[model samples]
Target chain A: MGLPRKDRIRAKLKSENTTVRVLLAHPMHTGRAKDEADTLIPAEFIQDIRCWRNDEEVLTIKCGTATARNPYFSFQLVGGKQGDMITIRWVDNRGAKGTTETVVK
Target chain B: MTDDIMQQRRAILKGAISASTLALVAASGLLLPRQLLAHWPKNAFNAETVEDALLALLGEADIADDAALNFKVGSPPSYAINGASVPIQIQSDLNNIERIAVLVENNPFPLAMSLELTPAVSLPIKSMIKIREDSPVIAIIRAEGKLYKTSRFVEVDIGGCG
Candidate 1:
């Protein structure tokens, strides 16, 4: 289950909407990369991602190994106000969970 | 429109920004589960080909181009020197968008990521993804219970398997 290191979320005011960008710290092994011994690394990548503004869930993303390591995403949330809590949560294929939150600015 | 449909439509229209309205749209957001184990779609993400993946995700429908969808892959070099992190942006003009999926046809697993969006989500979510080979980077938008798709060709100088 050893997979992720940490996760971070950033919320900012942009134009008419508040943009929330999340960065998940993960190795995102495709189960295809070989080691020095040329053995395939078992697939360990994020499978599900969920987002919430304050107490309400706003978005969900399902990702595969195609995503880059340290996956990053930016989504615009309507009515996201400063001081509102923005939470980013994720679970990997190995069943590891990581979550981080920040106040909208 | 029927009374229920009209009320739903009006709810979505006025609910675009309110917290209470977002809760209403979340029921139709396609994200039923809050925890992780039950939600990740194994079949669609693991499919090797695009058609099979789409079949699992969209229930076999004829997808047309919607002029309202604005998808742009940042001007990547003809040969993506850094195939690991390519930038892309998507914004939808269509109404009642429930899902937005980005698929790379040539990757080992074609479906990169699928966004389950609520009415609270505004458009133009810019993101970065890995591209290991030359493939058609496709964006599929599910709006108002219909399917619309568009794609751009991206070539990778260094491939995932090679």
Candidate 2:
């Protein structure tokens, strides 16, 4: 099977902008954790994240291992209306990727 | 053979096989460097100083203090109990901001995180970051080819990087 879908995205239309919140399921290993066998778990984390609004790029984040597990991010869109498309995609250290979309409500 | 002896023999064989398999994988170079696995931005994260990290990420250009730029930082109490994960939010009113970066001045890796904004995005970028000790948290923004900066001091009881 392919990588699991682990992202939850939501968008809401506010008075003057749109709010987007994203919760991504990830280990965010800091390259320091060790297993029961004492093997160092390699650092695996989301390196890049991009958010698009109706095919228009709005925000991009560059992350590192310091990010916590199941990282959460929230940002605002300058102008968006109901039914507008908001898409977010991220790629992790293992080359695993996930994308999720929501409509502003 | 007795049951105990048979069990011991099987355990030893299993261990030997797994050890050899691990060695083979290591020797074959199947495990790539950790940096290659992600866009780690080694230079910025490895920089010894905040200035160095900013230079590596944003170039060695002069940053001007602009009064027109409305930059605000939202964080917890002045003293944080847990430095490993401190919630922070940045909001600005400067027009046409293209990039925003957060820096923890005293962290081993001062450059905490950064965000690139497009025209469709608004201000107020929120996230969590680790802080090594009591330090000034800086927020830098790039707009119209100029860099605007702001900072707030935060005291940590226990350092994050143990």
**Which model scores highest in TM-score?**
1
Tens digits of lDDT, candidate 1, A12-78: 9777689888878898888888889988889888888888888888888888888878888988888
lDDT of 2 by residue, B1-162 (tens): 699999999999999999999999887777753333335566876676889988988898889766654443334545677776677777767889888888888876678677888888886777777677789888789998889987878888766653
| Span of ten consecutive residues with least summed lDDT in model 1 chain B | B30-39
Question: What lDDT is reached at residue A30 by model 2?
Answer: 66
- Per residue, candidate 1 scores C-alpha lDDT tens digits across B7-120 of 999888776758766687676765555443356778898899999899977777889976677787635533466667777889877877889999998888889889899999
* TM value for model 2: 0.75
Worst 10-residue stretch by lDDT in candidate 2 chain A?
Answer: A1-10
- How far does residue A77 in candidate 2 sit from its true spot (Å)? 0.8
Q: Give the clashing residue pairs of candidate 1, or none.
A: none
TM-score of each: 0.82, 0.75
Task: For every candidate, give the share of true A-B contacts it also has.
Answer: 0.82, 0.61
